[model samples]
Target chain A: MDAKTFFIYLLVMAGTTYLVRAVPFALVKEKISNPLIKSFLYYIPYAVLTAMTIPAIFTCTGSYISAALGFAAAVILSLLGQGLMTVSMLACLTVFVSELLIR
Target chain B: MHFYKKGLAAGIPIALGYLSVSFTFGIIAVSEGFSWWQAVLISMTCLTSAGQFSGIHTMLIPGAYLDMLLSQFTINIRYSFMSVSLSQKADDRLRGIWRWIFGFFITDEIFAVGVTEDSVSRSYMAGLSTLPYLGWTGGTLLGALFGSILPERIMVALSIAIYGMFVAIVVPELKKNRDVILVVAVAAAASCVMTYVPGLSRLSPGISISIASVVAALVGALIHPVREEAAEDGC
Candidate 1:
């Protein structure tokens, strides 16, 4: 793409992204009172994170076995209260080693 | 100042995670004909993985402008819900211009951290956001400049670290709350069905995730309403 068109594409992409993020913050100034809505919001973080993690995780690495090993390592380390970096690094290491062994 | 420090501390893992993923993005962007600086610019401005990847594909394939716009909107609209949920958690002292300024940084990882906080302040959010922003853009620049230099195995390993980070964030909560387990299970099941089922498998990642989350959360809320007494007790 040319410079002009690239610039326009960036502008539109940035604008749409910012709008989606900003509009809710601008509009929802007051606390939500409804029990159902509040509960739904409360559960969103866990629900979204879970949905994003699974199925996708299995496909992340070259082989499903390596990915599953990484995921299992992650869960165990995290449950042991390791820091995020630690858990991630260890899990990656597990995937690396497991991939080599599997091959 | 204390809260800012805490936020930065909390953000360290997120920044590190971003570094690896955005590095991969940088490699792809450069191969797609973007200059190193252009790829960095995309990361700095967009800060979204799926949307930018899709945007680049649309651009490279000579798609119409409307198609690019629609694809970006569809991929990123989840942020709207996340932002609204976070607005309820932010400290009341955070007002006016700060909201818009900080809202720009409300990516999924940041939103997850922010919503889990007991009380979120503007400075805390700013400190939390700045490092990951730098990591993303900086990693992109490096990746574009040094495309494919890393060994395949190492790159594959680094690529999966972000998922590890996500698991780290959610597993603790899942352990503490039975309701959380239920919500996660429902969402996971819904996502699996949407992903693997014959007809439903055609749904895009964004739409499938959104549907699974909303439906699961709604089911959770109906089945396990937080009683007024329990809510007050926690607060």
Candidate 2:
């Protein structure tokens, strides 16, 4: 991308991102009127993360084997109540090692 | 002072996370025909992983301004939802007027930290954002400068950092909270069904991800029914 064009592009993207984040607070405060709407907001994080992570685990390369290792690793590590750092390192190690062994 | 500490604490993990990922982006952007300053500017200004990823994907495709806008819109529109939800968490004071200042730095990592942290001063939240904001932008500048020199094998290993971070976030939540577990399961099921079943409107990765998340959130709220008192229990 041209230097000038790319810079402008970045500004626009940044502008939109900033607007999206700031706009909500501009209108709404702590007292949300509707309970159902408030309840739905509470669940958004878990749902968004699940949607992102699960398919990613199952659908990477190596057919069933790769998916199996990642899925097994996440479930096992989480079940063991591992901290975030530990679980991620374990998952990354499992995927890396399994990919190497399979190759 | 407390806000400063929280910002520093939150920024450490975030800075660590941004360094490798932004470095990769720097290297890739240079290779993909973006200028070094352009690479740095994009990372600094946008502070989004998927947005830049998709930006480059379409930049390679020989498109016009409209195409660029559409591509960016599709990938990054999810942040709007996150931003709106997070707005609720912001303190209603002079700091509220400065929402735009801190909101610009609202990435997936920042949002996770913001919501999880107990209610604190708005100045602190903004401070929290500033630490990562600087690291994220600064890391990309350095990475764009040094990244082109790294070997392919080493780079691939480093590329796994974001995935590693994702595991860090999700694994812990899944363990302690059944509400979190249910939400994740439902979101996954929704995404899967949407992908496989095929009658629904065609959705991009960004939209699919966002919609599934909202669906899961709505479901979790419906099922668990958070009490006002309970919200303060854990934090």
Candidate 3:
């Protein structure tokens, strides 16, 4: 894409994203009383994050083995109450070493 | 002031995580033909990993403007849910311009942290979000500038860190809450089906993720509606 087209794409994408995030905050001035809607909202974060992670995670690396090892490391570290940075770094390090070894 | 300080402290981990993840995104964006400045601009404006990744894919394929807009909207609509949920928790003092300002930074991680607070203040949310914002944009600049110089294996490994960060965020919640596990499983299954099930596999990643998350959350809500008492306990 040309520079002009790229900037337009950026603007449109950014505008759409900002509207999604901002509209809700703009409109919802009161507490939601409906249990089902409330429940759905409550579950959204977990559902969305989980959906974003899996299947995709396994395919992000050069090798599935390295990705799987990285995932495993992340899970174990998180379970042990490690912070996000620590878990991510260790997992990345694991993937780096494992990929080298596998090669 | 105290809350602002607390928010900054809490945001440190998120900022660090974002730096690494956006570093990977910067590399990908450059590889996909974005200039370093363009990648940084996208990170600064978009402030979303999945949506931007999908956007870059759409751009690389020469997709239509509507296609890009629709994809971004689909990937980002969850933030609307988060924003509405958080609006209830925000302090009454945060109104008008303040609400809109902080709302701009309401990513999944920011929303997660913000909504858990007893009462979210404008200053505190600003402090909480600003660092991650800087980290994301700054990391993009670095990655886009130096990505070609980085080793192939190192770049590949750093790419995994984004997923690792996602796993780190969700596993602890899944362990504590059966409802979370159920929702996660449902969403994951839905995602896999959309990805691998012949005809359904044709659907774009943005649409598939949007459908899976909404449908999974709906099922979870139907099966496990939160009691008023439990909702109160959460706050």
Candidate 4:
């Protein structure tokens, strides 16, 4: 895509995403009262994060074993109550070391 | 002022985490022929990883504007769900133009942090968004500019950071609550099936995530409905 075409298409992508968020967020002023709906909303963040992570995480580093090593390291460190930055950086390091071993 | 300070503090972890992820995004965008300025522009104007990937992929197809539009919607549809959730979490001060403006800044990470708050004001939201936005944009500029300089192995390894962050977010909560454990397991299992199954695997990642998470969360909500008393000032 040329510069001009890229610029317009970028707007299309950005516009769609922004509107998707802005519309509901701006319009939904009333509190949703249904217990079921509330529960669903409460669970949405966890569910989305999990669904996006699994399987994807395993293949993230482009090597099955290395990515799995990263995954294991992340879960272990997190379970042991480490902070987000620590777990993430260490997981990357695990993948780096494990990739060398695999090679 | 205190709220903004709290927001800035909260954003640090997310900013640290974003540096790598957006850095990867930068490399990919530049490698795919985008100029550093263009790549930074995309990052500046967008907040989603998957959607940006789809956008760049669409650029490869000549005259695929409609394709880009539709895919971005589906890929980013989760933000709408998150926006709805955040709408409920916003304080009285956050309304009208405030919601419209700040809502555009909402992403998975921001929403994740937002819902943890009892309420959000525009100032706090501004502080919350500031560093992560800069991290994303700045990281992209560096990556696009230095992409060819980085070793392939290092880039590949650094790619794991975001997922590791996700695991870190979910695991402690999973350990503390059985309901969370079940929800995560069901979502992960469903995600695996969608990823590996022949026909199902063809679906876009966003659609797959949407389906897997909504179904699992549905099961959770049915099994353990949040008490209505949790809602404040029901009128």
In DockQ terms, which candidate is top? 3
| Residue B28, candidate 2: alpha-carbon lDDT | 72
Model 4 chain B lowest lDDT segment of ten: B226-235
TM-score of model number 4, chain B: 0.81
Provide the clash count, candidate 2: 3
Off by more than 4 A, model 1: A1-13, B1-10, B28-35, B49-82, B85-93, B108-122, B227-235
Range of the 10 consecutive residues with the lowest summed lDDT in candidate 1 chain B: B226-235
Which window of 10 residues has the lowest lDDT sum in candidate 3 chain B?
B226-235
- Candidate 1 lDDT over B89-184, as tens digits, reads 888877778888888999877887777787889889988998889888888888888866877887777667767877887788777667777888
TM-scores of all candidate predictions against the true structure: 0.81, 0.75, 0.94, 0.87
Q: What is the lDDT of residue B176 in candidate 2?
A: 59
- The parts of candidate 3 lying over 4 Å away from their true place are B1-3, B229-235
lDDT of each: 0.79, 0.62, 0.84, 0.82
Residue B106 of model 2 has an lDDT of 70
B28-67: candidate 2 lDDT, tens digit per residue: 7877777778888777777887567556655554434565
Instruction: Report the Cα RMSD per candidate.
Output: 3.7, 4.2, 2.0, 3.3
Give the least accurate 10-residue stretch of model 1 chain A, judged by summed lDDT. A37-46
True-structure lDDT of candidate 2: 0.62
Backbone Cα, N, C clashes tallied per candidate: 0, 3, 0, 0
Per-residue lDDT tens digits of candidate 2, residues A42-93?
A: 5554565566665655654344575567557756776777644455556556
Spell out the clash pairs found in candidate 3.
none
Encode model 3's per-residue lDDT on B1-235: one tens digit a residue.
Answer: 8878888987887898888888889999999888999999999988997788778877765647887877788778778878887888889888788887888899878887887789989878988998999989998998899988999989888888777877887788777666777888999999998888999888777777878888888998899987774443221
Alpha carbon deviation, residue A11, candidate 2 (Å): 4.6
